[model samples]
Target: MNPAQTTSQQPRQDSPHKRADARRNHERVFAAALEVFEEFGLQGTVPQVAERADVGKATVYRSYPTKEDLVEAVVRHRLAELDRSTAPVLAEAEPARAFETYVILLFENLARDRLLSEALAEGRSSRNTGPLLDRLAALMDQAKTAGRVRPDACPLDLRVVLCGMCLQLINFAERDPALWRRYGELTLQALRP
Candidate 1:
């Protein structure tokens, strides 16, 4: 196969030069924003993000005009990655198994980065939990229909159970991985119908 004749697979863009600079600036902002937001939260300032990215504050403002805009960008990026990873699982796996696997993957992601976990440790923020809960609740409905999960168990309750377990694991994993592991198994078994 001739390489030149294969395909021009670059992402389609409205303007090549603008896209190039936008991509670079977006990458810089994402990296810095992820770190800074995780550390300082929604209150993280534009100057801090610019310093972390090693770009001018003007660049940060160009990419995100406000702190909420920056948080939205960061959340969008991370949630996009999570969606990619879980799409196949959601589509193809058995409902109960899909839910279990989703929770496990969520725990892994939360555990991998302290800052991300900390940002979401709060019980509020429907923005953070709404998508995840909806996915799990859909799976739970399917599982109940299939007799794979307890018919009486509420999906919302299950979501809370899983979230609470994960929070405990996040808090104590460093101090006691063994204890967390034990509780993890117990929680998983409890979710089984």
Candidate 2:
């Protein structure tokens, strides 16, 4: 067969420019979802995000099957942000100090992030919290190795404790913005060996 025939017979591939445009559309939808959700809370509709993204409603649905999925993406994004913030702390010379600082940053992000706080309250993103927990487990393992953390203080325990603390603090959002922090600090203290 001629090379031209072989090439023409093969399935066509998306051009690099088209692929990049698709990616840009996906990202635009992601950003618009977060923006709409923040402006109107998680109750914001997909159409709103489509409008904000300047894409069709089908485009948003194609990117995220449902509002929950979109919110879950945002939740993952927020946790990833928190996880990235702890990267520098992992290099601290003092293992225990690093762990404490990690917990502190976790609590700070959880306290201020309305999307995370609200999602936790509503039981969204219950399935995927890997980025944050993976980092926490690493830190815990390091601290444990140094004999600074309780042998049994696992990442799951920290997650439950933090979730509970954040959920409790959601009630105090209007009354006392700082009240939830003490619970986080107390929980951290309990985890110390």
Per-model clash counts, in order, read 0, 0
lDDT of 2 by residue, 1-193 (tens): 8899778756455467677888999999999877776545566799999999999999888889988989888877877676677776667647756776777766666666666666655432356655455666787788888887799887667777666676677665532435555675786777777
Q: Highest lDDT among the candidates is held by which one?
A: 2
Model 2 Cα displacement at 78 (Å)?
Answer: 2.7
Spell out the clash pairs found in candidate 2.
none
lDDT of each: 0.67, 0.72
lDDT of 1 by residue, 46-99 (tens): 889999888888888887888777877776667677889878877787665776
Candidate whose TM-score is highest:
1
